[model samples]
Target: MKRITSFILLLTLIIAMVFPAPFAFAAVTQSAPTTEVPTTEVVTTEVPTTEVPTTAAPTTEAATTEVATTEVPTTEANTTEAATTEAPMMTTAAPGTTNPDTVTILHTNDMHGRLDAEDGRVIGMAKLKTIKDNVQPTLMFDSGDAFQGLPLSNFSKGADMAKAMNAVGYDAMTVGNHEFDFGYAMAMQYKQLLNFPIISSNVYKDGKSVFAPSTIIEKNGKKFGVIGVTTPETATKTHPNNILGVTFLDPVASVTAEMKKLQGQVDAFIILSHLGIDSTTKLEWRGDNLMNNLASNKDFLNNAIIVLDGHSHSVIENGQLKNTALLAQTGTALANIGKVTFDLQGKNATNITASMIKEADTKDVTQDEAVKAIVETAKANFGKATSEVVFHNPVPLQGERSDVRTRETNLGNAIADAMEAYSETGFDTAGDFAVTNGGGIRASIDGNKDVTVGDIIKVLPFGNTITQIQVKGTDVVAMFEHALSAPTIEKDGQVGLDANGAFLHISKSIKVHYDLTKPAGERVYAIEVLNKQTNKFEPLQLDKTYKVVTNDFLAVGGDGYTMLGGPREEGPSLDTVVRNYFKAADMTAYQSTELQRILAGTASENVPGEVTTETPTTEAPTVEATTETPTTEAPTDEATTETPTTEAPTDEATMVEDTIETVTTEQPTSIQDTPAASVEVKHDNVIPFDQAVKQKDKSQHDAKAQTDKETAHQLPITGEAAGTGAAAIGLFGLGLYLIKRKSA
Candidate 1:
């Protein structure tokens, strides 16, 4: 009998060695981010190898990839490392979806006062409230800078936004630089109108935090300690005057203090932060900086489970932190709503996951009636201003920060033209040349579309007034030098723009030729001012004082134009000047100019230069991160802004995909597709969608590698886990063999 049993056991061992159990192969998959996705379309994959199971596992019914859609960071200095930390963001189940123990946190950051839907791009506040309602046991919050962009929100000085937010049911919020755009007092009024707390732990006045540093929110039998902190750049990000009474204190000190106080009282700590992930931000002010700074404290990392980030308008759908905590951010404007879920194992919050719910995902969600009424009311009041047609544009007006800051775009041309023409109407005297800072042009206007007063304001949101300054030709040269001083890179064929808020855009009446290849201060080889008297170009005289028209920001030496100091004469705001410019019958339509104002050489004359192949490549507009957070020099908004830009609301759908493609090209295919993936798995079971359906396909790998270079983008699973997971299959098989032998 013993001999027979040994023979059977040996046979079993041989079988195990030849065909490993699928469970054994599944060990490595255990570390898959425990995030819970909503009901998502599933693509079934089958393992072709005979030894492995050919049957495809059903994709989780109620879960999606909990898809991250974490757009690649386009800001020159930032990387996915800042957002992803060491792992993909995780959650155990969908927020408010069938998980009784889970508490959902619905949040938005850098909404920038987008109250109405922009075609299908922005779902508007009503739809946002629907998302909030779909997820039960939920609490909502806005990180900061919510009500400052659109006319509907700003018309009542954010009171409209407050009413809308109240209709949607927000639990708490933090202050952002733009929150102070109206004034500190207005921000306080906004708080008063809010049904919930507006916490800003680090902002101070009279030696005390002006707002509560943190608040306790109770839901689903769980107590959450929510701590809020604003960016230190707030000191000057708003009109330096708006924040005069309030001081932005040390965030690190303020946050750590809150952590100590809230340790044992709450189930978890949620850091409501406006400090963006801008790489250009100072070490002390960057959100990533504050995250690392918190690690020094003993147990702070343990309790802080998630951070809902803003200020850079980054599209970090879901990301992990070094301390194993999670972080999430929705791109700016009401483009996406963020959902966070904490799965409770009794009273302890265990599995935490984050996901971004785009409008497409919420097609079935009904708009909240209350929020819709509030939004409609605000729009009805501002309808004439926002909806009235100013003029139709023949072509796209490129005012993308990455574009305007780096080159002389058509939008820049129109702005400068407006400032120069202001002399005929608003200006008391005629001006010779007009200059507008690249940073002041906040948005892009779609071509062949009806432009409106709201559209103009969207492009020039800063409310900078038109002003005149007498700049000597030598000072003009110096100011241009300052504009070109920001460091830049050359890519494709054109010199890629180094994003700078101070970059100058000269009017059509002036021409400055310089070589980007030349060193900083010595780049200009020639300078010419359009001789208004002769209607011709003439060499700029170093000592001659030229009547220069510019925005008040530059006139006040904002964006570091120290040479701009001169006698000032203020006129209407820049937006009004542009509005009047567009209203002109001759301005019925405008087109993108080839090399407006600034040029690499004289060849790019007023006649319009031919676009290089590389220039068209740069035309792939920076999405999400495109809207600058309107900070001091850092310009945070999950971007380098992704400072916001939209040519048409319909174009937004395609651009959303472009934003993904733009981000994915920066990521490699090999890392995203792990070898263990040789065994077919669903995206819901593993990482993001992968090109490699069958890991053994070398031809596919080669083709995918080349494809990823152009447009296909992907995200990688935890590399260390992937490598170990593959090895676990073999080890698991061997363990079965050993166990069978011992039993025999």
Candidate 2:
């Protein structure tokens, strides 16, 4: 019995050795499933483990290939971990199935510092957050000018606006002219505080980009290249002193150069443009004009998908430019928010749809609690005196910005009269006429309504002072010609109104008639000046000199008037001037004068010479529209690599954590090191504003004088002095040699 039991125990031991533990078997199967066979090895080596769901089992050759590409990991263990922890980047590629990826872009432009709209119907950051929360695979961008309009924005020099935008989550923004309202230093400060990039391919400082030229962001395993473009007119649109060290390249040139760098690096291209769509804006600097210019090259436009534009406050929704790209812009003040959806198949955009959501329609939308808190804090900090009524408006003034910029309005006359009255007190002389640029007038008050100091400040925000300068009659005519030199739209061979900030608003002391049928310089047919000595209107003499009352801006060549010298004497601030005028006039019996200061004509007339287009000598660079085929090489597809990371929240106001399940790609090239217009730079020299102006003025004259002086001073010591010293040195050397020989 014992022998039999021993034999049975041995057999049992053999069986136990043959069959391993359940946990050991489990470990063998789960730990190295990625390395089981040739097929599994291929999957582990080439594909990302995160791309494949852990629950999905490969059933066919196609599924094997798909699973292989699911998640590419450096190690077998990492592959298993990725399969378990990471979400799939794409939907399962079933047999003979094609799926397109969808991406949503939310865009806003020209908010103009109206953060909290007095009218709830106007769109604000709060409503924007609600839409962002509902939308998936979304990105948010601003074309430009988020600040510099409302009291909230201006009071903080755009600091508060930056904070609010940061709280709401803006991915990127292009530079705008109004961004320079608080000066370049302030703009840089705002950019530093914001979480997103302030990008502009064309804007440069000291031979380097003021902001990054472009950024490549990935969503759903697809890459998008966003390029920023700002209008070259920013130089003139803002104060010359504001952007002292900045230079703006041609938008077309900058964009094409940047697009070449992003061609193979990104799946799609988008342009965040602050260049408005209006054709009359500064000689082909408009968005449409720029698109047409770029469309000349089909290859460049092939990758371009959309342009979000601002600056002219014109609305163009879902409009196709050159049939190559989609374009959209919401008018000023956030009345509407633009949205575009791109259906991408592989790397190409298969379909695109554009639309706008009006703020009024979104009244029931939920406001983001975080953004609401920020805005509330700003409003609470604003003083109560801003709402106090400073004076009563007997009648509604015709001072809407559009009207003031494009035509002669009664409000323009009243403002000009106030400036003239103030200038007379400062100069102690009767000036010819008070003139102001239309851009100086920002808002108008309703007639028979109580006007507050805040209202006046909004209308005249720049704080310019009344000043007087003596100018010749010929210079005055030249100034008038400059005022009317802007290109006007042609309607039946007659010039029609176009928006130009340099358009002049004059006081009652001058009467002028212009014929649109005539050439630009010869358009002025008649001019009459009120002779203060004779108290009657008389023909202006070209040689006669007149003391002109104008704003300090105009005196220093703020507009296009170069001959108009800088402010000779300063008076009260513009707002103060207007307030003093209001105090002197009877509040209950105020009446705006119906003055005929300017008359328009439709017929042609004879004139002297060809119209010269020379503007005042200012720091702004003159922009000319030109077309040239860019010779940039297309980028390679190896520029980007996909990763298993999720995208960050575009609108953080509503969501602090990123719940987005996506695939992000890292760009191989860094924009900071390689600017679009980069050149080998040895030094970053900053030229002082006044010194630069002086150097520019003396450049030609100093050339000859500098050369002569350099040539005369080329030799440090004269030949005659050298010859005498050489003879003395020879005698001393001989004496020393003789002494040395005697001593030896």
Which has the greatest lDDT?
Answer: 1
Give the alpha carbon lDDT tens digit for every residue of 1-744 in model 2.
544554555555445444523332221112544644322211010111111111122222222122233222222222111221211122211122133377778888878766675454356777677777666325789999886666556656667788888877777888887776665566677667787877777676544456667777665567678888887666555545555556666565566666766777777777998887554454445676556555555555455467888777766656555554777777667777888887776566646778777777787788888887877777666544356566777766665554555567766766776666665545667577778887777776677677776677667655455678888878888788777765566434544555556778877567566666667775665566765565455556777988888776567565445667743765655666675566454432224233356656532232322211122121111112112111110110001112101100000010001011011111111101110110011111211212333356578678988886676444344344445445545555555555555557
Q: Which ranges of candidate 2 are over 4 A from the true structure?
A: 1-100, 428-430, 487-495, 586-595, 602-744
Query: CA RMSD for every model?
Result: 20.8, 31.7
- Clash number by candidate, in order: 26, 13
Per-candidate TM equals 0.64, 0.65
